[model samples]
Target: MKLPINESGLAASQLIYGCMGLGGGWNRDPIQSEHITQAHEVVELALENGINMFDHADIYAFGKAETVFGQVLKEKPTLRENMILQSKLGIRFPDEEKGLPARYDFSKSYILDSVDGILSRLNIDYLDVLLLHRPDVLMDSREVAEAFHQLKSSGKVRYFGVSNMSAGQIRLLQNNCNEKLIVNQLEMSLDKIGWLETGVHVNQVAARDNVLPEGTLEYCQLENIQLQAWGSLAKGIYTGRDLENAGENVKNTALLVQRFAEEKQVSQEAIVLAWLMKHPAAIQPVIGTTNLARIQGCVEALKVTLSRDEWYTLYVSSRGVSLP
Candidate 1:
């Protein structure tokens, strides 16, 4: 069964694959046109593996990402019916376009203009999901909602959501929004335990990795919003030598991943997916790996389960201490 997406109730996969780093068009010092071909291969792989949701943002590679994805749709017109295409608006990259500082714009005219740019570039009649890339502090939610309402009423966009917003901010938007706020794109991971705001002893055990946010899971759960986890790889902080620096339980959990992967005949990365799946809250991982084999490994994680003891072992390791 397709999962319920917002109040409009579109069916979507629980795991939404992110097409950011995989696209090769984002932030490349010298972006090659040939890289777009590689991006299509990723789309092919996603379709082959049953990943129906594709995430995009207008500011990505300065609209080239949307163009690349549009090419896929145009080349294979039939694929559009089966896939749920999503894109973001409101992030203006002035540095990329005008060689000036970048800024966020949420004016009604700017929102409509961005939507047109998204539609023209994607070559789609409408978007399955349209999100505000980030919150604009001066955003007039009523004016923004007017555009959303018009878009929804016109069948140009089916769903509305926000990215990287606080619970209070979402409520503020929802208060003005006639349509429901569907998802909150967030940065979440095993190493980043801030989602649940799990009170861990950082100074006593290990220094906190500033990469992950704190208390997002609990807040999202309370607000009835979905969390999209980004950069979910087992890299950084404990890259190699610091694997020991990461703390003892962390080591045990890693050993556990090796053991489980061996037992299940899957890659260690699959164990990471399994661990994320164990969370009670809806954690739709936005995986960015372009490698097809690695992508397959992530899918394998969905099928595998981490035992209760093992889940805690990793959790304890993440905290660098036994659960008190």
Candidate 2:
């Protein structure tokens, strides 16, 4: 339940409850007023299960995610010190009146202003972590570094991280920013690891190639930055579908795995989570499930150690082929 720490020395739960799903549950539908109480109650459930970290983005549900998270904090303000609350900035929501300014904003002025906005929304004086939601190709390292310095010195944000950034992009800012960015929350999952390879996912075949380099994975390991895995359930891609091994075989395999999950006293989601945790790298999987039962199952992944061969088997299943 304790956090998986990184080089910059920040730590929080290995299983961070993604707040996007909180604004709207798995159905991507808003929680009704009747459900709001229990919805907020889920925060306590997550915390009791050792999930002290919560991940949210500024644009999630057009900012309702942070608002709801703020409500949870207000209801349990005393729990603030016990948890590591985090959110991201950057993605400007579209507004016709605002000249349709839908784009990534990493400018110094934007970054500073975003902090104040998030502070007011979350009702927290300071954040445990603040991430640049995604890389801005036009990002100026000097501008970002200056904003980071100001935020850290003013105690507006205690820790810094980046999301959806490549190894090189992170280095660009990391080198410039005097305050160390503690982590990089990449959109990584075993299935989404096309970033780890150099195919169409990385483009020997596309015009604008995937920015992730072949050495990206190796670089993170060498640098000691904890990779937070998003979309860990393959975005529920295999829910009722076949395992990569056999199309017709999924019904039974899925049922069997689901049964094992129950017998092992974990949800099916946890099985996927455990698969990620099996990796040696200090990676954390962000779980977006709103069901407390499923949330608890994900937390269980930290202890479920898959054997080396089993790990590859799952990898092969995910790839729909054996490794070369």
Candidate 3:
């Protein structure tokens, strides 16, 4: 399925290969040959399986994720043309030496500089989409608009979007920027059911406790903004994560996932992802597994189709409660 990334005839894959696990561990570790080999294997495998959209962030692996990915592009530049390369910026990790706390930045200069850094590390000229990693509480919409204008005018980025933002926050940024925000990525998965709960819990006590901003899902659907789901795999919770210390609801959900996988003859990863994709919003799930077998398992989701009963069964099991 082609995702409506923009009106410029650019479309992304139904699944996005998240590169957070690339370039070794998150530290000042050097990019070793093993890391490079693993990257090549992952990229080659993902491309072979029809995943043409890759997601990245500057903060992933202390910037080494993009760095190693750059090696893949450098070795086989043609691969760059076949895929939709996307990366995000704006999150600044804490630096004790600089006397700085971890914070988000959306200042004009920071945006421009971050884009340059992202492009440089990825060894790319322009990004298919550039997302502000998270909303900066101190963001000035006008200032961000101006920065976007410069990036667009100079051909540094083709499109713009935001991540981890609420509907109200998106509206505020949309009001100031000329660019139409095309994507709003958030944590959505069977494990993170707040997005679904917000809709189902209306006029009920559960509504007050839902973490997803009300109307966020509907607003994205109404605006034609592509909703991408990060943490969509829920860190392998239901699929195969150890449930020894998990709650009753989680253990039950995991068992149900296995049952479905067995009945459908697909990987548990596929069932987990298919459940998320069943939503009408057409959410693009970002899968970050570095394991080759797990990556192959994730792509199996495209083959399985869960009916309404199956979908709700997983949902109710995960929530451990009847719908209000």
Question: What is the clash count for each candidate, in the order shown?
Answer: 6, 1, 0
lDDT of 1 by residue, 135-244 (tens): 79899989988989988999988888888877777878889998877888876667776654333433433326443334545667776676666656555332222575
Model 1 lDDT on a 0 to 1 scale: 0.74
Candidate ordering by lDDT (highest first): 3, 1, 2
**Candidate 1 — which residues are off by over 4 angstroms?**
27-33, 96-100, 198-216, 234-253
Q: TM-scores of all models? A: 0.85, 0.86, 0.98
TM for candidate 1 is 0.85
Model 3, runs deviating above 4 Å: none
**Weakest 10 consecutive residues, lDDT, candidate 1?**
198-207
Q: Which candidate has the top score in lDDT?
A: 3
Candidate 2 wrongly placed segments (more than 4 Å):
7-9, 24-32, 98-101, 198-211, 239-265
Best of the two (2, 3) by TM-score = 3
**Model 3 C-alpha lDDT per residue in residues 1-324, reported as the tens digit of each score:** 666664656777789999999999899979999999999999999999989999999999999999999999999999998999889999999999999999999999999999999999999999989998988999999999999989999999988899999999999999999988888999999999999999898888879998888899999989888899999998988887888999888999999999999999999999999999999999999999999999999999999999999999999998988877
Candidate of highest TM-score = 3
